[model samples]
Target chain A: MSPVSFFKCLADDTRLHCVLLLQHKGELCVCDLVDAIGESQPKVSRHLAQLRECGILLTRREGQWMYYRLNPQLPAWAAAVIGQAAEGNSVYLKPALVRLGKSESQASCCD
Target chain B: MSPVSFFKCLADDTRLHCVLLLQHKGELCVCDLVDAIGESQPKVSRHLAQLRECGILLTRREGQWMYYRLNPQLPAWAAAVIGQAAEGNSVYLKPALVRLGKSESQASCCD
Candidate 1:
């Protein structure tokens, strides 16, 4: 996909958060994202759908749960963008990561 | 600036082209961008203004011309992201660069 479409996928607050969380955690289920982002399940799901539609994210199904991760096939530059976004704005993302970590510490739904 | 804002700024066709050109050419003036992207001067200027407002680009004024380049202060990852975008999508951007090159080959207004 073109870089414009790739970046357009990441322009939203919810979508950007989902991508950042996936990048940070490697993989997460919808519930994991919901807990981490403190947004409703449907809201999180909608953003995930947008990311998926743009081909930036890939999904896998495990029984009743859906797991999400950054598309491994994403061009190097796209990953670099996401990586830099995560790094340059850690202060904004730390809380979400911390929350996801805590949720995983308690119990990961993906397991 | 936050990653969302940064990406939002680039999500536009015009703005993204301006940035890709700036990244490819190192620096370009408003007229150079207008010629390279084949857009009107006002539209190019507007996108350049948006990019500047978001801090992704820095400008220098020389006489009647203002030159623009990627913000040097951009985090390494951000630069890498732009670099990768330019690299991964050269096919999409080649024509614009060629046009810009041709324009320069003839005569550079910035000179």
Candidate 2:
């Protein structure tokens, strides 16, 4: 993706948080993101749709659940940009990570 | 800056070009960007103002010209994002760089 398109995908709070959380967690479902980000499911799902449209994310289906992960085919630079943001901003991701951990321990949304 | 804020600064075409140009060139004046990107001076300046307001760019006064550059104190991650965008997308910047080179060879904006 062009830099503008790539950056646009990350310009919003929901999208950025979702992308970063996925980067950290490898993959997550919509319910997991809703639990972690504390946003309504529809809102989180809307942003995920946008990211998927932009090709920054890929979705997988297993039975009834859909999982999202950073697209493996993302250009190297795009992946690097995500990596830098994810690695460099732990404090920003901590609260969501905690929520995600709590939700996962309580029986993951996918489970 | 927060990743969302940082990415927002680069989400627009004008702002993204101005920023990536500034990143590639080290520093530039409004006129230089106008000449390079072929956008109206006011439009370019307005975006530069936003970048400055977002703390992604710093400006210095030089006689009748105001020069813009990436803020040196920008967090490492921010700088890395810019660097990755610049280094990985030479083709996106090529047309503007050509114009910038021609503009410089003829007479720089600050000169």
Candidate 3:
């Protein structure tokens, strides 16, 4: 993807959070992101669809659940940009991560 | 700046080109970007103002010219993102670079 397109995909709060969470967690379902980011399922799903359309993310289906992850085929530079953002901004993601942990401990999503 | 804000600053083609150009060139005047990107001067200056407001760029004034460059104090991750985009996407900026080179050789801008 072009740099503008890639950056545009991450310009929104929901989309950037979702991408960073996936960068950290390897893979997550739509429900997991909704819980982690405290956004409605539809909103999170919409942003995920945008990211997928931009080719920044890849999806997999297992039964009724869909999982998303950073596209492995992303150019090394693009991946590096995501990695740098994810690695350098842990505090920014802390609350979402806490919510994710609590949700995981309480009940698994997409089960 | 937050990743969302930072990415937002680069989400547009004009702004992204101006930024990537500055990242590669170290510093440039508004007229230089106008010539390099083939955009109207006001449009290039407007985007540069946005980037400066977002703290992604710093400006210096000399005589009648204002030069812009990536903010040196920018967080490492943000700088890395710019560097990676600038380096990995040379072809995207090729025409602009050629324009910049020709303009420089013909007559320096803001002279």
Best by DockQ: 3
Q: Candidate 3 lDDT, tens digit per residue, B1-111? A: 788899899899999999999988999999999999998988988999999998999999999999999899999988998888888899899999999999999868777
Assess each prediction's global lDDT (C-alpha) against the native.
Answer: 0.87, 0.91, 0.92
Candidate 2 residue lDDT tens string, A2-29: 8898999999999999999999989898
Superposed by TM-score, candidate 3 places the C-alpha of residue B106 at a distance from the truth, in angstroms, of: 0.7
Cα lDDT, model 2, residue B52: 97
Q: Point out where model 1 deviates above 4 Å.
A: A107-111, B108-111
Q: Score the docking of each candidate (DockQ).
A: 0.70, 0.83, 0.85
**Alpha carbon lDDT at B92, candidate 1:** 84
Q: For candidate 3, give the DockQ.
A: 0.85
| Global fold similarity of model 3 (TM-score) | 0.97
Residue pairs in candidate 1 whose N, alpha carbon or C atoms collide under 3 angstroms:
none
Q: Can you rank all candidates by lDDT, best first?
A: 3, 2, 1
Distance from true location, Cα of B23 in model 1, Å = 1.6
For candidate 2, write residues B9-100 as lDDT tens digits.
98898998898898888999889999999999999889999999999999999898999999999999889988998888899989999999
Model 3, position A87, has a per-residue lDDT of 82
RMSD of 3: 0.9
Q: Please provide, for model 1 over B30-90, each residue's C-alpha lDDT reduced to its tens digit, 9 standing for 90 to 100.
A: 8899988998898889889999998899999989999999999987767777887888789
Candidate 1 Cα deviation (angstroms), residue A59: 1.3
